[model samples]
Target: MREIAVVFVLLAFLAHSAMGEEMVFFADDLYKAAATPELHASLVDPAVAPGGSTALKIVVANSGRVLALLPTGIQGSSLEASREMQEELRSVDALNVVATLTAKDPVSVLSGPATIPLLPSGTAQPVEFLVQVGEGAEGPYHLDLRLDYEHQIDVRISAGQASPLYVPANVSEEITIHAGGSRESFRADYARSELWPGENGTLTLVIRNLAGPAGNCSARLLAAPPFRASDQPVSLGYMQPGDLALATFWVEVGDNASVRQYQMACQVLQDGESSAWSSTIPLTVAVEEGQSIQIWLVPLPLILALAFLAWRWWQG
Candidate 1:
């Protein structure tokens, strides 16, 4: 009888200890709620070009609270469900949460100060990360957001025995970004490749705004030695995305221009700055010697008169 009582006591203590330990599990709905249409991450601006800075907003709402303690084997007795139950609800400091952003393609983070600093319980915090897309970027990209945090639970065993337990919290979320605008909308190319020395010809250029927002824009040509721009600047008032514009300049080929190809520059001007918004492209100019001309036709009346005069002289 004595041995059986000792065995029961040992079992009860084992059961109690198991119930006293705290176990932290993330709510299954945590990530799902964030992925919802209303809470999903989004870009502040719909349009962004490579090397341009844009904002990526990440919203995280933690509904996860300490789970209730399980009942112990002893009748009319309960083990503290969890350490958190010993203390009332506490706010999770934003400083405890650490967030990192990554993508399949490399991106530069420009958001100042910090990312996802103070996240309170039962409330959503929208964190914005200013970032610049890398070169060679195209439409449709996925960014990986990793959040690491610590949940501190107050454990009180007795007077002067209060201690805090730290639970590591880690969560990963993937957000989609639709990157647009390839380089600039405007394109520059030479209309004609060949030029003749000492001749006035049209330097035809075709400019097109491909796949971008509409705005007021202007264009200009920059020429080097042996190539001169007849028109310094041309007005391209309002151009919509994918709009095409044409500009022609009458250029005189220098008499000293060599037969080799010379490069001319053309670009789209920015609204306020002297720099060009679009990339500068080389316009190839090839100078060739003028072709020789020969007269093949004479006046019919003069030829007939000369023939008659010759006949009269021969007859005399």
Candidate 2:
């Protein structure tokens, strides 16, 4: 009986060891490194501008036994012509802000100090960051991002602290890239405010009409870290003389929604008839759990009737 008990215990230990074996993970990254051309050359880049906000983004993948940690830091930067535009870029609310992790796959990601977390044992999750450039120094300036990471150790780790990266880190620094500076006029208009959750919240627009018809238009939503369209042409449709046709479409936010205001837009047709739109109407989502929120526009139908009555009395 004693010998049998010892044999059972040994088998249980072996089974647990087998289950704890580490699994290898892998992912491929197609990256573009930034470079500088001769100062005299003109390159067209719609990303960097003087007075507007252009986003800088990069993707990262990790495979390890524990969550990956990329430290807080800057990666790279490009120059922009036009001092006026530069001032606007630098002056925006989040301008000159330090780098922090903005997004991650498997979703529900947020910023953290020191290091950002990466997934383990799977090549499917990709991490992304949104760097907002508010008012920043003139072009020809070097921007830096500190890359740091942490991982869980087999031993105990203290609260609010982390172990060093378990996997090797390979982030490309300065590859090779150039930039351009050309002014393109832009305009965006809203239809009204108020939208339904998981429904299409639409907007209209008129851009570069006076600047010579319209060019490329786009739609953007600033929920938090800033999420804009990645593969969409949020542009306007066609129109007839004196007839303002549609310009942009709304994002279907699906069934899950919360109380929030959204901005929206559309654009005039010309030069690609491009369009720009806000993510939401200024209207609140007015959603509640286990209940429905209804929002309707209250129109004053009697205003026109009262105006006609007053006109008749004045004529008499």
Candidate 3:
């Protein structure tokens, strides 16, 4: 009985060792099954101008190689092994992919996150995002592209086995775009800066083209409350770089306008494109109170009339 008990203890120890070895082998197989999908992205058009709206085209692809090995120590038929291997290869495909783009100040992403239902291995898909650049933006800017998706890692083909492991992947990439430097296209100055309430006057704006040449350039007054432009847009004709021109508008001030400095703007249009205004130049003007009649002057007129009547009566 003692010998039998000792033999039983030895058998149990060997069984434990065998189980440990199997686990180690299974862990190694899982490591071998681990694969990462390769993705590359870039902007379709890398050059952009400040104060402009554009689209960013991102192309995503999966270039991961499929694994050709089965889990270790599994005694399955060739057909079963083939099926499992196929499933493992399919795991290289990215599923439920989501992409997000982020930008810093002066650059804004107008569109929301882009989505992809499936990205099969060795396949590429294109996604677009609308971007708006501020007027002050200049030089090269870096935009962040983030990709999130689920990818299958391993498949279990036994009863009560856990479902295929779908691992979440996060990829961060940087995209560079060159933005043209911003320059003052035009400078504006007012010819007359003061007007009285209930007054009609001609307002002149001296516009100097500081940047590029423009043709059919015109300027219109953006008169708000308390001011109105009676004339249409005034033409400045063709202007070369560094050229100066004048635009005049017949303006009427409201009677109830306040006696203070009022802010105004001038809209400059080029090439008869009324829908697209090149720039808005800010302006400032002051409204003064009208002069009142003096009390002495009013009495002098009445005294003169009375004096003339007395002289006529005495002469009669």
* Clash totals for all candidate models: 4, 39, 0
- What TM-score does structure 1 among the candidates reach? 0.37
lDDT of 1 by residue, 103-202 (tens): 6555666654335555544445657777788875654466676777765433333333334445555667665554434445567644664467667666
Candidate 2 is scored at a TM of 0.28
Q: What Cα-based lDDT does every candidate model obtain? A: 0.47, 0.28, 0.60
lDDT of 2 by residue, 39-141 (tens): 0000112133333444333322221221111111122122211221222111111111122333222121133422334332222222233333334322222
- Give me the runs in candidate 3 sitting further than 4 Å from their true place: 1-32, 67-71, 158-163, 181-316
From the highest lDDT down, the ranking of the candidates is: 3, 1, 2
Which sections of candidate 2 miss by over 4 Å? 1-184, 204-208, 214-245, 263-284, 288-316
Candidate 3: minimum summed lDDT over ten consecutive residues — where?
A: 22-31
**Candidate number that wins on lDDT, 1 or 3:** 3
TM-score of each: 0.37, 0.28, 0.46
Tell me the spans in candidate 1 whose CA falls farther than 4 Å from its real position: 1-47, 65-95, 104-106, 110-118, 160-162, 181-316
Best by TM-score: 3
